[model samples]
Target: MLQLLRKIAFPFSLIYLLIITVRNYFYDIGVFKSKTPNTPTICIGNLSVGGTGKTPMIEYVIRLLETRKLAMLSRGYKRKSVGFQLGNEESTVLDLGDEPYQIQQKFPTKSIAVDANRLNGIAQLEQLIKPAVILLDDAFQHRKVNPHLSILLTSYACLYPRDWYLPTGNLRDSKREARRAQLIIVTKCPTNLSEEDKVAITRQIKPKIHQKVLFTSLDYAEKFKDDLGQTVDDILFQDKQIAVVTGIASPEPFIQHLAALNLNFEHLEFSDHHHFTATELKRINGFDVVITTEKDFVRLNGKVDSLYYLEVAHKFSEKDKSVLKETLESVF
Candidate 1:
């Protein structure tokens, strides 16, 4: 049924594709100008719509560039406040979007700000503090500010080459736009990705001569944690029944991670960036141990006592990490 609906929407998807293609053409031909910031700026984005492991990839970049003073800028998707809002001591999930707020909480000393306009956000961030490097989260399609280095992410399961435009498929922009990125990372791969798999994907993506492709997988933490910093034993979860609550674009990997542990759980899935209501909170409170993604944890932290979040990070070979580091250093 869903496939049929998507097939019916194919014409509209073509229309969307044409609109995006023309817009990108204007930028390419210099009809639309992209501002180049004085400070080094890096963009972590995806060719598809969402769920390409962007948050963890951004965190990976942050960890890699820990020696330099950095600031993160985002569009603050679904945030309540308007205009350029710099993250401060009082910044909450409502002030910055969930992902930005989560990153701010994790890296308290680093500056984080959000504005729909990337140019304005960068200007404001520079006026406040001159960060050595600025990281732009999910700003691939926002061509107003030209980034010195752009890292494009695509999921192993749903590569952009196999996707279509929005309302019919997952892609928000044309697949050809991926050529703009210098580094293309295939994220959320299985732990044991074979060489044959790499060759196949590389052929499908057909990256430009200057583009480099790297593969990475998600490494879940050994244990879960609660609001009060209490750790939950992984052994205790063996054969135990728990509830999995997630409000992210893709939760299959997370669900499969928990299932691999031989734990039984009922998944209570919600739309991406879903804001929990009072009634939903009451229902979630009934669960004994509710496991959620780190992004969702920010919104559900104080809502339930039994709620715990599973931490995830990017897992890549040291050689690949070195390649990424070298590429960024070249821009600096």
Candidate 2:
């Protein structure tokens, strides 16, 4: 039924997309105009609205450019306040988006800033960090900024050009918008995916010659222990059932990760950045223990009772890094 609605609405969505096309034409013709930085800028974004592994890809880019001072810039959607805020200390998921806060928490020394206006946010960041390179999170659609390198991310599950628009599909913009990018990444690839899979996906995507297409899979952090040195027994989790709560763009990866551990769970899904209440806590009381992703942990900072966040890290294979390095070196 949902698929049927998506197919039906696609025509309207495509017609609505003409608005974006006309706006882009204005920007291109200098009627709207765009800004370019003298400093290096790399964007990691998807053609779809949600969960093409942008956070993991951003982390992938940051680690690859190890020597350079990297700052992850974002619009900080659904954050409490508007405008530029440095994301190192004194920033919360309530203040910045979950992903930006997550990056700042993991990489404290690296600068992180957020604002809806890409140009304004970049300007504000220049005053403080003077980053060697700026990594724009979900900036593929931000036509106002001319990135040094544009990376278009698509999910292994769904490619945007082939998908329907919002309320029907995950894409915030049209698939043709992807041509503007310098590189394309098919993210959230399954582990042990063969060359046959890559070839099939590449053909399905039908990228341009100018685009450097690559693939990556998410690597999760397993065997989490508490603040204490004691290792949390995996046996206990297998012996007892657990409750998995997540309010994220995609919970599929986390669910699969737990399944790898042979752990049984009852999942509680919430909207992204959902603020929990006392009633929610009473419901959580029925579970043995609660496990969630690190992205959701920030909102749960003061609310922990039996909750434990299963943290994840973005790691690419050595060969994939080599491919990424070779591509970026040509640009930066």
Question: Among these predicted structures, which one has the highest lDDT?
Answer: 1
RMSD of each: 1.2, 2.3
lDDT digits (tens) for residues 1-332 of candidate 1: 98899999999999999999999999999999999999999999987779999988888899888888899999999999999999999998999999999999888989999999999999998889899999999999999989999999999999999988977999998898899899999999999999899999999999999999999999999988888768787776566567899999999999999888877889999999999999998888887778899999999988876778889999998888899999988768
Q: lDDT, candidate 2, residue 142?
A: 90
Task: Itemize residue pairs with steric clashes in candidate 1.
Answer: none
Per-residue lDDT tens digits for candidate 2, residues 1-332, read 97898878877777767777787778778999788876688887876777777776777777777788777899887788788888756767878877788788878888888899999888878877888888899888898899898888887778775776665677777777778887788778887889898888888878888877788877876565443324465666665658888888878988888877888888889887677788886787678777777777767655655667765655556776687888776656
Candidates in order have lDDT scores of 0.91, 0.78
Q: How many times do residue backbones clash in model 2?
A: 1
TM-score against native, each model: 0.97, 0.91
lDDT, residue 286, candidate 2: 71
